[model samples]
Target: MKKWFLISTIVLLMIINTNPASAISNAPIHWGFTKGKNEQQAEAGKAYDELLRKHHAFYKGDPNKKVLYLTFDNGYENGYTPKVLDVLKKEKVPAIFFVTGHYLTSEPKLVQRMVNEGHLIGNHSWSHPDLTQVSNEKLKEELKKVKDETARITKQKEMHYLRPPRGILSERTMQLANEEGYTHVLWSLAFKDWLVDQQKGWKYSYDNIMAQVHPGAVLLLHTVSKDNADALEKVIKDLKARGYTFKRIDKFK
Candidate 1:
């Protein structure tokens, strides 16, 4: 009876091990991603393609309307993401974070915190580069590198949006993003906050951002700089006063 029990256990282990669904995918995402010739092409680059994709909505209408979409690009891992999260929490607002693998692998807890706080995290590619010029294979690597790492960290299934590095886009880039199951999020509202200039204080940013505020505004800021994190609270208040409700840009909003 003991021998029979041991044999049953061994068989069960084998069955589970051989199942594709049961196995963890540890393979490198870069193994298949390649670079494209979009930049060199006389016409347009190849279309973007990926193994999976995720995005719920795009720009609904005119940019000058009442809605504003707040987004931040995460290139480097700044200790400030938590502070940014704190500000967002206090204001009860939702913003999109365009994140890179550097940020994901280095600051995983912050990513979890972002998810917990009900904010959208977008695939900002593995490395920050112009996606419009990369091949579909490379495009896959650019996105999955983060998605896979994020999955491992969050223990969650998947992410929804992907905005390529530098906000660069091409036919191939769009196709690749689509294939990867992501919506190519573009910003109708962005200013010098992307700049690293420290002189561009909260007042400068506030005025510039406020001037450009319209419906469905996908405002881009960086988490690495003291400027953005510092500007968060005041910006939220100013927008509130202007009668704009901070929200996720989607079908419902």
Candidate 2:
């Protein structure tokens, strides 16, 4: 009986020890704080520069008229994502999730749930690295990594939107992403919402988010915020009441 108990314990330990770190491959992006400057890199990538101009022209400087797009960046899953999803589900609003490679691999079910529920999934790079700092080759690889992983796991066509890590953009990063079939995305408003170490309560963040909302606002939220989860549904309801309808990014020129 003692031997059987030890064997069972060992088996359980083994199961826990060998689980995948990401739903995908093991890479350095999995183990580092994604830090960097991207606007400088765009100057270097002529193609990236063109992409910026293209999208700017596409919108014709009128993105804030009777439409709103809500995008969440998924660098790491929060304990709150499930609840956030619950709120979104309850409200019947479809939003976009710009996911990193780790999010694709660590939360495969969430990826599937995003697609199954008709929300768009855009690429946020493989490891959330600042694209402008890496070489063009590396940037392309990063772009492909997230796009491929998310599509492969979810069995969906790769979406065309790509949000830069830390909102950093470069000519090179933009060019590479565009060449690879993505339009660079940046938010009009984002605060210190990504730091999982700090616990700013929802009431504070909610007021901040509400204060920032405008016509055709593309609000940025992170998956790792308790305040975000708490504020999400309430914000959605409050925004809807105030005549803001949520939609995926509808213009990509």
Judged by whole-model lDDT over C-alpha atoms, candidate 1 comes out at 0.65
TM-score of 1: 0.72
**Model 2 Cα RMSD, Å?**
16.6
Q: Which tens-of-lDDT digit does each residue in 206-251 have in candidate 1? A: 6666665555455667777667777789988987887777667443
Q: What TM-score number comes out for model 2?
A: 0.74
**Candidate 2, after superposition: displacement of residue 178 in Å?**
1.3
Task: Give the per-residue lDDT digits (tens) of candidate 2, residues 90-177.
Answer: 9987778888888888899988998888788888888877766676678888878877777787767667888778776655455556
Candidate 1 wrongly placed segments (more than 4 Å): 1-65, 251-253
Winning candidate number (lDDT): 2
TM-scores, all candidates, are 0.72, 0.74
Task: Locate the minimum summed-lDDT window of 10 residues in model 1.
Answer: 36-45
Quote the positional error of residue 161 for candidate 1 in Å.
1.2
**Top candidate by TM-score:** 2
